[model samples]
Target: MSKEWFPLIDEDKCIGCLACYNKCEHGVYDVENGRPVVVYREGCIDGCHGCGNLCPEGAIIYSGEYKEHIKCSCGCSD
Candidate 1:
């Protein structure tokens, strides 16, 4: 399966608490320079919000929800 979800850490907002790094059971995060980094993007599980929800500073952002459709600008109908 493709890497559909991963964590995005905001350096400025991160308090270096390591809450996210510890919360992630998939080894998706690591500590470097007192900040959490996405070391293993492929290990992230799709649609899981465990790390983001555990982050105290709200520094972790999870992306990769699949969208079913896109609006066409050319006025085409599927």
Candidate 2:
């Protein structure tokens, strides 16, 4: 099956601009530790491609579930 894009944020790089938070329609990004964090990542778009591009600090990434989600529990069919 085809994988999907997830949200991610780099704490060190994030400038806490909230630009990404304001732009995202999915409500996936949030503020934490003075940085934008991908909180509701799994509920984010399965094909979401809008958040990462707008980040001025380039803190966002589309990888798995929250970009850091490296483990596989995708509930897919065999």
Candidate 3:
């Protein structure tokens, strides 16, 4: 987990969907009033965007510099 890596949810864009909450396996998110919050930011994995990818409303945006070395869902690391 990286301290600089975490998901930032845009409340205006969020529809209170639990997509991010259910997608995160690192205990990085928590539900409050039906919306997902980044309660455990330090728990977020470095270069991991699983939660953001699963968000339908594109409400989740990750911090830190984008890493191109990480592998994609298609198994391509570019």
Using lDDT, give the best candidate's number.
3
lDDT of 2 by residue, 3-78 (tens): 3566667777878888778777666777776667777765565645556666787887667543333332222111
On TM-score, the leading prediction is: 3
* Candidate 2 segments exceeding 4 Å error: 1-4, 65-78
Against the true structure, candidate 1 has what lDDT?
0.73
lDDT of each: 0.73, 0.64, 0.75
Lowest-scoring 10 consecutive residues by lDDT in candidate 1? 69-78
Q: What is the TM-score of each candidate against the true structure?
A: 0.75, 0.63, 0.78
Question: What's model 3's lDDT at 9?
Answer: 94
Candidate 3 lDDT tens digits, 1-78: 347666899999999879888877778889888778889987766677787777898998878764443453422122
Candidate number that wins on TM-score, 1 or 2 = 1
Model 1 residue 38 CA deviation in Å: 0.7
Rank by TM-score, descending?
3, 1, 2
lDDT at 35, model 2: 68
Backbone collision tally, model 2: 0
Cα RMSDs, all models: 10.6, 9.1, 3.5
Candidate 2 has its poorest 10 consecutive residues by lDDT at 69-78
Model 3 lDDT on a 0 to 1 scale? 0.75
